[model samples]
Target: MTTWEPKSDLHHYLRVAREALLWKLDGLSEYDIRRPRTPTGTNLLGLIKHVATVESGYFGNVFGRPFAEPLPWLDDDAEPDADLWATADESREEIIGLYHRVWAHADATIDALALDAAGEVPWWPEERRRVTLHRILIHVISETNRHAGHADIVRELLDGAAGLRADHDNLAPGDQAWWEERRLRLEQVAQAAGQSEPRP
Candidate 1:
């Protein structure tokens, strides 16, 4: 919960969150980043790759910075989930480099546009061409944070370790046993109501 207004200057907070999301992959092996974190194999590196490609598209292609890279998933002939997971051949550095490039292009777009500056979304319906930087900023921030939350859960599932970082803030440090009992009570309440468990 932040008290700061998410305005034109809000890029700082959004950028921090985005970086934190990427930092989740730090110290992880190439295998770790590519390993299945979910039934659908939502690995950490894959999520970063997806976000990088998407950020490049929305902020780059939309605004015309146009990041040039050979994205296999972008190919019409490739698997739809290609960007969703890493192949054995892909290295961690390669994916990270791609993400950094995408970010650079995205940042360039942001630097060029004012909050009120208007542009067009080419893929939208014909009547929806005109859009403001404010809208794009909001959309990208929402998209990044949404995906990052997925990353958070996936990372925690990968290891019992959790939090935005791997350290001091991970534990609540207050009546955790009581909290655990309360959680179990909530689970019993839910089970009594015919629910299996809480969703996320």
Candidate 2:
């Protein structure tokens, strides 16, 4: 019989979200990974970079255990959203490598502290600045999974590749034709519903 561990379970889910986000970049060319997919300029590589910076801060500085490398992009004087998009000079490997390092640093922090260990969020409002490892873990996991969800859509928009994971897509089993038919059916329903609505 396996004993239930809350921290272990949380860490496992966090790792799952992290891997899913990174998996979105696999098998894509540099341009595809870095090109802006949305009007606001969201991209695969940028998502990874942004999450890395986020983890580095929440897990690193929040716990008084800063990540070794300096992140100039996160500095106040830096251009807004600097961490959200990689420049031409930043290679895919570099961004991915940084994420891996951040994961290691974050994992170390998790291992070192108890779930109830106290920490401070310097950037948060004063009343809410005080936190615990458990709270931070939940926050980081939520943030990572939220961005992973973004990667899912951006990746599908780029290449029609969509899934919760490579191994198990977590989608209904259907061929391309089946999916197209389903989409057309849904579109018809949407149009019908719209027409039935009373617009002022």
Candidate 3:
């Protein structure tokens, strides 16, 4: 086997983290991928969807090379929560493909700009004038991983899976009965904690 090297100043950590986030969603069904992990309805597919939009926005649109796509969740008039939970009719293949394309756009942003190349985010305060591709890469990587953790939980709640990274196959070995036992114990503990009152 041969070791790989990064082709540019885009940095290795950023590249690996980006690939890792996309890898986490592999082999999941649309319904399986879209179930809300929290009471707020954060999910795996929706996370990827949001990343695609934001990446394309920051890297493509902000730089004046707008990506060509009809992103409905990004509609400013729509409720913000709508972007966090996917609606029905979002095909797994389509969303995943869009993410792949967004990666291309983000990569181009990296390639075309120097580490110190400056940018101004119009949405931010005017005092914040300059930014760098290197910094943006780091920010997006952190953002992706942050939401990816939420994805991991959503996956576990849907099917009892947990890990910072899972390579397509389910490494969890316990049977459903074992999981049920653990889950019930957790629920009981949570309930007891919720009802406990402060000492007077």
Candidate 4:
């Protein structure tokens, strides 16, 4: 067996989380991918756009290695949360392409810096801005995976599709009918429990 390296393991998890978020966009049309399915305006393509900007900022500007590309959405004059959604002119391919490039940029930072390499997050408070490569990697990995989980729910709401990945679903074994029955059973239990509750 190969020896475990902290950096390599962290990178692997980060990549996995990135892929999981991207996979939610698979087989979706421009309209569907851009459609906000939740009250919070969560959408597949928007999530991709958001994460791209997120990675670019965290790995680029935070580390003093800024991305060459100009992110208009992240500009000082831009509206708040502009990076959270795609505009009309921004095609799906364009956003996805940007995300891929961001991944490469982030990977380059990870590759070049040692785990102990120091950096500062300019946007963060002064007292807590200083950080190391190891801390950033863990933070980004956690952030990416959190968005991936949101994407999973958004995709499920869109088409009832849910899984950890293409190869492994990690869901309990059940046919469509079985799953429906399970849902009904849960609803019944919930209703019964609600009825038994004493008046407040």
> Can you give the lDDT of residue 177 in candidate 4?
100
lDDT tens digits, residues 1-200, model 3? 96653335345665665666666667777777877768777788888788777788778766666788778776789887565656787787887888888888778777787766666667767776456665666676778778767676677678765665555444466777987898899999998997895766
State residue 178's C-alpha deviation in candidate 4, in Å. 1.2
Per-residue CA lDDT of model 4 for 101-150, tens digit only, reads 99999999999999999999988899999999999999999999999999
Q: Quote the lDDT for 84 in model 1.
A: 75
C-alpha lDDT of residue 108 in model 4? 99
Model 4: per-residue Cα lDDT at residue 104: 97
lDDT of 1 by residue, 1-200 (tens): 85754564657756876887787887777777788877787889888888887787788667665778768788889888788777788788888888888888777788787878777779788887778777888787888888888888887777644666544445565475876788799998978887655667
Off by over 4 Å in 3: 1-10, 166-198
Worst 10 residues of 1 by lDDT: 165-174
Worst 10 residues of 3 by lDDT: 2-11
Alpha-carbon runs more than 4 Å astray in model 4: none
Please report, in order, the local distance difference test score of every candidate based on alpha carbons. Answer: 0.77, 0.96, 0.72, 0.92
Q: What is the lDDT of candidate 3?
A: 0.72
lDDT of 4 at 138: 94
Q: Which candidate would rank higher by lDDT, 1 or 3? A: 1
Q: Each prediction's TM-score against the native? A: 0.81, 0.98, 0.75, 0.96
Q: Model 3, 89: alpha-carbon shift in Å? A: 2.0
Which residue pairs in candidate 3 have backbone atoms (N, alpha carbon, C) closer than 3 angstroms, thus clashing?
156-161
Query: Which model is ahead, 1 or 3, in terms of TM-score?
Result: 1
Give me candidate 4's TM-score against the actual structure.
0.96
Candidates sorted on lDDT, descending = 2, 4, 1, 3
